[model samples]
Target: MRPKMEFDPLAFFTPSLKEDSVFIQDDSLSVKAHVQIAIHQSVTSERVTSWHDDSCDECEEEEDALMPLHILDLPMLRLQPPYPVLVTILKLLSPDEVLNFEPSNRQQNANPDEEAIFREKAISSIHLKNALTWLNNSCPRLNASAKLSLVPHLSLALRANFTNEYNAYMTRIVSNELSWMSEAEKEEVQSLASMRISENCGRMAQPQLKRKIHLANLEKYGREYIYLNEPSMTNDNLGLKTWGSSLILGSRLLRVSTGSPFLKEPVLELGSGTGLVGMCCCLMGMVTTLTDLPQIVPNLQTNLKLNNLENYSCAELDWSAPGSSPVYGKSFSTVVVSDPVYSSQHPHWVVNMISLFLNDDINNNSVLIEVPLRPSFENERQLLWKLMSDQFVEVESEIEDGYDDFGEMKFCYKRFIRKI
Candidate 1:
């Protein structure tokens, strides 16, 4: 028979996380310690020593405290997108049975029998209130149409006593980013305001140009990312949206056959759209700088904070204005580029930027670039290959498939070491 487990007070309870460090909390006593649970293995011993040094007697009865414990990584707490989750949540909150939000087949895949239980849980006043608060604060950079469409559903949810919160959020939206929305868009919103709330409840499709997509690298690093993307029509710069090559490049960079070069070097990523690849480098314990055009810098910065990765930084670097001086200083050991070759002129501009920013210590430094194969940029692709190969030898090359802004496109990644 297996030995019965005993309740151990010093069994390493979950320490409260404040930023990067961890702390212990009791009813009347709160102690902050430098011992990080995730990074350190001997947390209990360290905690005992730390508490003793700090003169705490809560667990002093036990001299040698030991417990079979594993400090597990915390699961990421992410906001569910407002479309389906919020829509169903709102329907559950409304007292009036005007709208019937039957679960879609995809939603039923989780557990068909627990629909009532899920609905009851969703209707909890606290959950509903918290959901609204999160939506107001952490809402993605959505376009006017998407924002306007949610008004009806939001109205139904706020029908009880939460109108003030809804009104405040709407006012802020209108006065802030939506202020410059076209006159037609304002009229469209006004028209929708009077429409039946039930009909619009099910019309929750995200527009093509302004979809919020999440890309995951959980296998490489332990986290996934959320990115707000605008199609080429909405934003002139394609860097506003994430491309498939960034994923390919990110995975390739993390799963390199050689030693983890990223861990040893200061890395710079050019054309870092949504900063997915660069952020992955940071997750792998490298100091990564994500750079793009000035317009895309703010959004990239927002993404960094959204993912709780403010340790990584962002900068503005236009390849067209490739300057003589190193933009991010002169010490970047690895330079990464994802889908940077688009137009014919891009090859020269991008290569020049790489040459300027990438370190000259050929033996120790390298350039990692992933370029998609597009028929329109065939000549430009050849030019980029020629220019990079002349100055840098291809230490590692991978011809892989990835999606571009338009969808799946074949891509090739090359790790280049400057020729001796």
Candidate 2:
């Protein structure tokens, strides 16, 4: 069973992952996470140092105006209690939830009696004490000044929120090294960090069991299920987890299985990360071969077994060397892929891979594709389209609004009929 507690992003001062949190993995065990078919320069910006700066008086004043004016925005700003206790007392809520949230006097609720006000405060005090006791028991080392310096920055994070300062400040505390703690204390903190990444990035990297396959839309309904076990991230291995487009494509297959105009008959799911799309096709009574890189095949097999899909098969077809696979030169009615275009070379590689296995009968062959409309990969998406257009024409295409762990996003789905 999965643990009940993972890392909490907002208040990370306390360690809740475990007695020796599994989230704090040993540094030596890290895997090199490169993926076969998919794809940083560190740059330090020149700062406005006192020696280099020679801006005019007006510019200087404007800069000064941008600086935090109140004590609340600076290091001297005080929390009612000091050090570790302060965070618990303040409730550690987002500033928007805490600051200036109440409306005008006319819109206020009827004034509470002295008893009501006292009761609320008393209850809050009791909760705070209970939380503190838990914290002390869970983390004895936190009794010292370990978190003394965090109060001001947490305040600034709330005040400045999305500004450059806030991002920089947060990054400083959590990035490459936890700057606030000593080296001896880093491994403990890093465990939580690994278990709990801040936002969308963390969501993608964490091990997740996602129930994303649309059972409601399927014919088999509750009889068929997809349970994906995504493992923890290493470096660049994006294929371990099912991408958003896989769910999108799987749903599409289920929707059209009754009288699919686009399917060629037998299907080959290329880059079958987590085997979602191919398994969906097999469940629809289609012959399917799900293939990906050798490193990705084991997990593909796992997901296959998870859904009792052992009858269907998976093979390793390296996009860069498609002929090496057993499925090479074997024809399929449709060659399908979801979110496959990552590296710059992917466009040409994908086109070449399809040519070897996608049936040459132009009148009856097609490629079914669904990819996220990622802004960073706009060029790659366009290039893949252009390359596909040279050999295939779009038979059906639509842009659909969808969401994943990363929040709302747009995905492009298309059925491309092969041209002679």
Candidate 3:
């Protein structure tokens, strides 16, 4: 068997990895370049000790906030056109037209020679009502996206007759309710319209953008993550967003997995929202089941499908009503949960669920938990630790500095074995 390699968390933000450190390909990730970033949680004893960077956590966060984003790697985040796609897009342009590859200009002025093709067609919309249809037909998708982004072309079509095209499209959007557009984009368009009208559309105030779409960008895991943040879904919709506690815990598990004794057979993750920690377990070849409340289960299953883990499992398990689940009586050697303590009742409920599902054994079974130290939840956090200590011996506890979309936070993770 090939020996496991040690990865220093500090080295991740650097420009390059050590050449001497041999890298191997994993099928979980689409490419090796993606291996540098992972977000999830799991941990046990062994080589997982170096996760803390008390003196330098700030520096690391500054360098790799939330996730390490580099300007050259914007394609990975789906922000910029990838080089390969750019090459394909460039083919749509004419040979003599010389569209400078610059991005900031929006469009370049067309030379006299470049206007020859449009001149023959005599660009103009039939009328204001059919402007979008004309634009759709006139502009080929690839050509418009890649080539011929010239002011003269738009000026020719929209200059005299098509000047009303902008207002026409605006009216259609407001009346039709463009659901396809993001909440943020639609809100921006509404703001623009209000400025033009000098008042609200009809109501005293316009609706705000509450829904957010997050792209996890897991090229490292060869997994696709499409998450929706709809706070309006429920009061306890915390499952919608992936938290940093999960990332910190997952990173620790990844770092120590080679010799870690923590990952016992048939791992079960409780409160597995968005299922990042569960995905980490599955990637490690552990038999894993990701569980959450009934409402959150659909997103969990969707994430599983996106990550190419159809063969794995996700189930609905409410901590408050543990026995209501078919899995309530089942036993797992390792049980994990992160950021589960939110409400006052959560401390007792989470501990109760862990005890019920985790196998009763003196030496073999373990429970891993990670939770952020939110200022509001200090009392609950303290109560949770006290309750946990009553039934399990705390093998290791560490505070990790972490960052998520909400920003930087301090998280405490604990490793536990059943008390004899």
Candidate 4:
């Protein structure tokens, strides 16, 4: 029989909140109810940096000389008490409950600095101590699985209050580096950790951010590919334009082709970094093969297993060599590649290799390739199109939109149908 787990709220909450007096005993409710209340309150009462103020003259003013002075856009109020303690209180407090409430008056609009301090104090004086007491006594059931999923929010709450205990907990979690766990478990932990790290360090701190190639949306949802390797593709070496465009085009193709006769078709991805596109294809019920340099295979495999995709395989393929064909066998009806045309010298070889896997009988096969419209690769893109036109007819060509932290941009996708 499985061991009977005791309720140990402190095991998870204490480490995240960094305070011993936060939980309280509760006789009135089940452990799950207490947890739900606590989480819901935390999510709902989260600090809002912006507030609505219709009474302010600035709302109605346009081109008025006093508009800037009348506006009351104060900086966000940082929580005074530890966020964990406050979250606990908000959960227990009734909707009608009021404690030390203070509204931002229009008269104080001109004094931004003074208004900021008042907002902070008002939010802090709400007294989270009682909430913490209830949580402690309730003894919620939180385990590794729950903790992993909650880490991102926990980290954010802890960092806001600058609690060393929570920081220590985060350090321990990352230090464990439990990469061997099942895909769901790994992602539960990784997603939280990645988000926390990204949040704490401003975007500029991560210079290689642009180079982090995500798998195409299709591969992500389809779960077709298992791994992505990019040894030469450092974040700094490549721009977001190339990576974003490739994923957009690849995802669009997969979205439109779902449930077609090609659903279960075997797919191969070249230069598969972070295996995003290929993984999406796998999830769509296709067998996927991801190829890149040997050094990147381990990380790629780790990501595949992290995303719960077990149907994909990975291998190394140096596109410039004539002997590289050993990695693949049997023709594929649909061959897919993204942003592979980096260097001008290799387009011909890459095109020739793509031709090898596509059936010569044009009526039954298709090839899909995505490339960016950069000045350096204009000639290479032309060469690839010319090579494909020799055997296959252009079936579809269009510019697709891609997403980024900033916004979205258009990308190019060209599909070729085999000609008889």
Candidate 5:
């Protein structure tokens, strides 16, 4: 018999919070607008500096006024407590009871105190202790940081509770990095950063040369192509690593005969983890842009430069953001994504991103997606294909078996064009 897995408190807490978290991520415009209005009201005619300029007293005062608003806007901020608070709450939790609390439990509860009690107690678990230890050690050594992201919040909490100067410094660095700077400028700020590998997840830190390469042979083109990507942090974001479905998708795209739409048109890839599929498209003579979150952009840029592909470029694209105002403009006739569906909101967000970015040329526009069949993600996976079918008509599709993070798995590859 397969060994039983231990109950994970984080996992138990995640589903309950994910919908609200996604809500916050997608609707952050309201929060930003509120902060801007507050700043204008409070700091009329005050001397200001660029957000990255910390030495200016005026800038520091402006930030002090803004920080509280920023923290208050986070949908699940209250759920995230300082380490001491987390431990105390954990000590009071009954793991079995906490795990069993359903969404309906909230509706049935007449007393608000009961709900608060459950939320506080939910943090206690052996899994959380291990995760906390990892975070405590990893935060200081992290090569990059950003505000409004989880890491900085955790660092700030630690600083407040333990008064650790390093944590305080990390929080500041992340905020600086979030300032308005060109991607090139951002790279300069992180140039001195040295990344450390996570012992548990096999993730390599920045400035580390530990590289893994995956190659795909294109017999039709009489050559082979290579891709390089390093392992990512243990956080669920898989963009830092390359998966087998991506390699398979790359190979399949390369093997397609000449005069295909991909060969002649500009293509944009969403959630371009490791840039494997996009790099392959570039090799096949297509202009391509590979996009992901800001944290993953530096490493993705490194991989593109590693292969000496000039036709391909990297951009920061957050799918949860309003796609109509994408950081990178909408200019591509084709969009591609591989293994992107994961959370409850991912299907809607990913499809919405495609709709916003894809050109309106009906005969020429297309989208190709490769999905690994994982039982855990079955519901969301079905939702993705269903949503795609509603918005676009299927042009062609295929299914195959391959190796994924979970070992051997079956994968579906589908190509679609806009519905009339």
Candidate 6:
């Protein structure tokens, strides 16, 4: 007799377990009919089981092939755009997987100019209404410094390409909020204003052309008695080119004069344009007085402030006119001027002015003048030199390099030491 098989419900339903033979629930009286029928069914069932096993084997092979793809062993997804897409992929990646995502050259070559133009247009159109909305909506979370950055960009847009609608808006914002700003914020606003003006002008933009002309005039007249003031305050091409040479020679003379143990006297700089030479004297510990026309006094003051020197004072003194005595009247140890002989009519007048201001004490008094050796002013320079020689026993002259905007020129310095 064949061994009896127990029925298993799970094995009967499962496709994998139907491979060998069919099992009967009861041993029937007729093995020919029931048992034969079961055997026939079992034979057919085994064929179906073999087909399912083959199908499962094919499926397992396909899944195994796709496993490497799920791990992203290839570089398909990385070659994409929109930074957020890359960020998302990066977040999904492990540290080692992230190392494989190299930046694509093609993606990097995408044009940003369109984006920039759009941003500029949008920022330019940000009017008062929008700015106020932005402030109301965003400012509570931002610090004062961050809030300050918004105004300057808006100011630039207003001054550059924006319509009056924007300017009026900016003006309102500034007028209302600027006073409440900290000192640093106020400075930032001032800087923005200056930057806007500079950007619009494309150069060092002066507020007034007339003021510039007046300042230039001061430089020209003041250059006669102050050596360093020539190139600094005046825009004269000749004066700037001759400056370097004058500085070298002037420096030598300054050393000789100041080296004297008994020469503890104040220096006076006439026509002290930007006050460069006079400032040099101050640096050497000499109290120096700077003078120019009335119109240039404010500019001179500004220059002095820029240099952070406290020992110098500016006054308006026309070399042609007799004036109130200066602070060190008749007591100035040194009187200095640079490029003062540019005009023919003014040479003699400058000489007379020098004569009047020189200390009567006579022992330690000296006048130093630096003039460019331009052909046009040669006669005037000679006349002034002669006048100085006549007034002082010791008159000396030297030639030095001069600085001009175009290049360099030879300049002359005439020194007159009064005889006791």
TM-score of each model, paired residue for residue: 0.52, 0.54, 0.52, 0.47, 0.50, 0.43
What lDDT is reached at residue 323 by model 4? Answer: 57
User: Candidate 5: where is the Cα deviation over 4 Å?
Assistant: 1-216, 219-225, 231-234, 322-328
lDDT of 6 by residue, 1-420 (tens): 211223221221112222223222111111111111112211211111111123344445433221111112211222321222212222112111000011111112222243342233232323323333433443332112222222222222123223233234323333433444466745544444333333233112212211111111223233222312212223222222123333544455455545463334477777665556666666556677877655555666665665566667777776665455354254577788876655555677677777777776656688878876755456777887777777776467777764432223577776777755
The number of the candidate with the highest lDDT is 2
Q: Which lDDT values do the candidates have, in the order given? A: 0.51, 0.54, 0.51, 0.44, 0.52, 0.42
Distance (Å) between predicted and true CA of 408, model 2? 1.1
Candidate 1 residue pairs in clash (backbone atoms < 3 Å): none
Q: Assess candidate 2 and give its lDDT.
A: 0.54
Q: Give the winner by TM-score.
A: 2
Give the clash count for model 4.
36
Candidate 1 matches the true fold with a TM-score of 0.52
Q: 79-187 in candidate 1: lDDT tens per residue?
A: 3233332433333323222111211221122112333533432444444445445555554321122232222222222221233343343333334323433566444
**Candidate 2, residues 1-420: lDDT per residue as tens digits?**
211222222221111222210111111112111111100111111112112133344445434222222223322112222232323323221121111111111122222242333243232445445545644544333221223122222232232233344334334334544344457545543443333223213333344433434444564643444666556544455667666788778888777754475674578998998788888887777779999887788888888887876347789988887767888778998888998886577777888888778887766688999988876668878999999999888888999976554434689998887786
Q: Which digits, one per residue and each the tens of the lDDT, describe model 5 over residues 1-420?
A: 211223231331112111111011111111111111111111111111112333445544434223212222221212333333223222321111111111122223222243354344343345354434543443322211112122221222222223233223333333444244456644433232111111111122222222333344553444344646554344444677676678778878877764686444688988887788888888777888889876777888988887788677778887766442344565678898998877777898889888877888766788889988766678889999899988888878888987532234578999888888
C-alpha lDDT (0 to 100) for residue 7 of candidate 6: 26
- Among residues 3 or more apart in sequence or in different chains, the pairs in candidate 5 whose N, CA or C atoms overlap within 3 Å are 90-124, 195-205, 195-206, 196-205
Candidate 2 TM-score, C-alpha based: 0.54
> What's the CA RMSD for each of the models?
21.9, 16.3, 18.3, 18.4, 22.1, 37.5
Q: Worst ten-residue run, lDDT, model 1?
A: 67-76
User: Residue-wise lDDT of candidate 3 within 284-356, one digit each (tens)?
Assistant: 6678999988878887787777656643678888887777787877899899999887667889989998888
